[model samples]
Target: MKNLIYLLFVVFFSTSTLNAQDFSDIDKSPMDVTIIRNENHSPMARVIYSRPSKNDREIFGSLVPYGEIWRTGANEATEVTIYNDMTVMGQNIPSGTYTLYTIPNKTEWTIILNKKVHVWGTANNYDPDKDLMRIKAPARTAAAPIEEFSMAFQPITNGANLLMGWDNTYVEIPFKNVE
Candidate 1:
């Protein structure tokens, strides 16, 4: 009887541990990171954001709305870390991590880099006073619709253009390294 009880306890504890170790379901909007390197292949800047799928719904103007500030991605506010000083749209931005925000319009989008970080969804937490710089980037229609929101760095002669697209709209923010 003692041996049987001990065996049962072991099985119960093992089962409980296994269940506890199980992971939860994947996030609906998964996190993604995109990094850009300099001429020597050294990291220049990185963007950490969550990609939310279109799911057959209207993204811009309807779901996201126009002339309103967007967190630039889902879940936590999108973060941009610059390893060195860079010029965005001819405006100088120092090396640091900043929250990326955008105001999308049909003609163009206002790209904002804010000093705030570690913020959740932008409900009442966004403060305009913390903004470091704001630049306008023209919005263009992509040939194909992107199912998921995406960001990529397109290499240029001096630096790289940070491309962002979702649904059918796309925008590019140019970043030039300052020597």
Candidate 2:
């Protein structure tokens, strides 16, 4: 009787502790997103983009600052790997990966293009001159927190539009198909 009670107690306590641990990333993660494109140029163009939800303790500022280069998001900079040339904001961007940054404020934020791609955000190897484009867009407030950062393309007449919105902000960058 004593041995049976002790065994059950140990098993139940251990199971409860393990279950208490936060398994937040079990179903949802930053890597999960809908990659939309209008790649008719043959091999299919690709662009990688990400939005962050909780940064450290705070949402935007603490994890992602107002005036600093964020690795786009937590862990590493958010990456957008492109397989071909595309025009954004009326400028031609060649086939390569680029790190997307934003200057966030109450109303508007400017999107950035740094030539260096596939690196951690805030790695400090960025050059402003290599920036292919900068386009300003409006940020909209949301009633609730967006648990996941997301990026997707909306089809347009001339090209595919990269629409980004999360945590009360939105931006659109048009990627014109390279012809």
Candidate 3:
């Protein structure tokens, strides 16, 4: 009886230790997902990205330089999934997954949809030859400053507008469902 009890205690402790896991610290720029659904609640579009905080520092034209391609988010490249055929900026886009890249400018932003997916940040990984679509969206000053990077969908008569805001700048990209 004593031997059995000792063996049981040893097994329990060993198993408990073996089950212990070491996880990394929380990310500074946390991952986020925004999805736009149809009237029937079926998902139409989705964006997965990391939100980096402003941290009271200059964001545009400084931290994220202008006239250059940005990964569109922190850490990994932003992923956009389209569930149906849509028209953006008068250009047609089929249902598929793509990496979202952008070029920030004071007056407008050039939105890019690339064929590549699952890429890390845009450190020499972005290829213009692989670009599926490029559209220009006007940038405007926000009513209030945003502390963190954000992406959301606003419903419209045609389809939905993908609104991106960071710091004091915001831009809207419309996605119209193709009949």
Candidate 4:
């Protein structure tokens, strides 16, 4: 009985140590969410994405590459949630969660609002036909470089602007509020 108890303790200890080793201390690009609220402080729209730092490396036209479908963020695909039905870039997008994708170019970017959500990494599972809409947004150079990826919604007349900025470039997608 004593030998059996001792062996059980040893096995438990070994297993606990091994399980603890599975976790990592290193942090990957952190996840972030941007929410747009109305006058009543109600959330109108929100976006969830990972923020990847430049890390002294070239972003866009090189690291991310030009004219390729980017996940819009790092790690998992960037997701956007619309609380109410709205028009995005003249295309009606029903209120729902969606994956936001982008095809970047030197002068412009094709921003897509995809029906697919909660996907991982790039456009590996992308279906262009399922995209709710695709709109051309001009890429504008920022006055200064922004090292981390960021997306936010800015208030506008009867609508909002979805701004995406990273490195030295930025783009804006307009979304009109629906009653």
Candidate 5:
């Protein structure tokens, strides 16, 4: 009887633990992260943004629109943290957290780094005067279609490329370490 009780308890506990292991995303748009590491393997810069799936819809020049400011992600404004002082597109930005916004076009995209952080969707209250810097990057065609919006930090000689792509379009913003 004692052995039978122990066996039942083990089974019940194991089942409960298995149920607890289910991690399901409730939000249609899921948050994602991109981290740029230094030579020492420590994070030099990081970005937190949400990924919005295409879902058979037009992504650029239609859903995202052209020549308009976008929050650069889904739910909240995309957040970027710079661990150390860096130069982005020839403009110096001190080590700190900031909101990343973008104005996308068919030919090119303008990347904007703002001093404001913790902003919610679309940056309705975005102040142009608070902009740290704005840089233009030419758009490129992706080799394959990207169904979902994604961002990545591609390693480079001095720093990394902040690459954002969706629906066959690719945009890259370069960031280089200051010291």
Candidate 6:
């Protein structure tokens, strides 16, 4: 009787634990990050962003392939808000919320901003007509993978560069700071 009770208890506990486990979205988790640029704007200009690492799992020709449209992140297409208008890659970009995306390759990357906002990745589909602007930048190789993907708006001499990277492929879209 004692042995049977113990066995039943273990089975019940195991089943309950198993049933309570969450397995959804385990394959794609995003790295949460907040990027800010406050140099020439008001008190601490900021933008929220996120990206998942394109690490060990073959980012080059798989996952995020070489020469394919990547939403620049796993979730809501990595949104950003420039408090003041800036010039990116020598092109004028207005201040507002925009969806960020990228086309990656071994040599270069095209950074893009679509007029649309608040959408689940590239699922909603991007229309080139809706593009606010696109900037082409070259990719620089790092000695190693970044482990975790990261995005940050760093203040440059007269602008800011939106930096992105994972697994040695690093790139930046220089946004000429606007006063």
Comparing 3 and 5 on lDDT, the stronger one: 3
Which runs of model 5 end up more than 4 angstroms from their true locations?
1-25
Q: Compared with the true structure, what per-residue lDDT tens digits does model 1 show for residues 1-179?
A: 99999999999999999989845677989999999998788999999999999999989998899999999989999999999999998899999999999999998999999999999868997899999999999999999999999999999978889999999999999899996
lDDT (CA) per prediction: 0.94, 0.65, 0.94, 0.89, 0.92, 0.74
Q: Candidate 2: which stretches are off by over 4 Å?
A: 1-29, 39-44, 49-51, 55-58, 61-63, 123-125, 142-145
Local accuracy of candidate 6 as per-residue lDDT tens digits, 29-116: 5546655546544622344555566545777568888888787868667777776787776787878888787899889998888888
1-179 in candidate 3: lDDT tens per residue? Answer: 99999999999999998888555677999999999999998989999999999998999999999999999989999999999999998999999999999999999999999999999999988988999999999999999999989999999876899999999999999999998
* TM-score of each predicted structure versus truth: 0.88, 0.67, 0.87, 0.84, 0.85, 0.77
Tens digit per residue, CA lDDT, model 2, 33-66? 4454554544334555444554324555545556
Report the Cα lDDT for residue 91, model 2.
76
List where candidate 1 sits over 4 angstroms from the true fold.
Answer: 1-24
- In candidate 4, position 21 carries an lDDT of 91
Ranking by lDDT: 1, 3, 5, 4, 6, 2
Candidate 3 has its poorest 10 consecutive residues by lDDT at 17-26
Q: Against the true structure, candidate 3 has what lDDT?
A: 0.94
Against the true structure, candidate 6 reaches a TM-score of 0.77
- Candidate 6: C-alpha RMSD to true structure equals 5.4
lDDT of 5: 0.92
Look at candidate 3 and tell me the lDDT of residue 48: 100
TM-score of 2: 0.67
Model 1: weakest 10-residue lDDT segment is 19-28
Superposed model 4: Cα runs more than 4 Å off: 1-24
Candidate 5 deviation (Cα RMSD)? 3.1
Question: Candidate 4's residue-wise lDDT over 88-153, tens digit each?
Answer: 877888899999999999899999989977789764688788898889999999889998998989
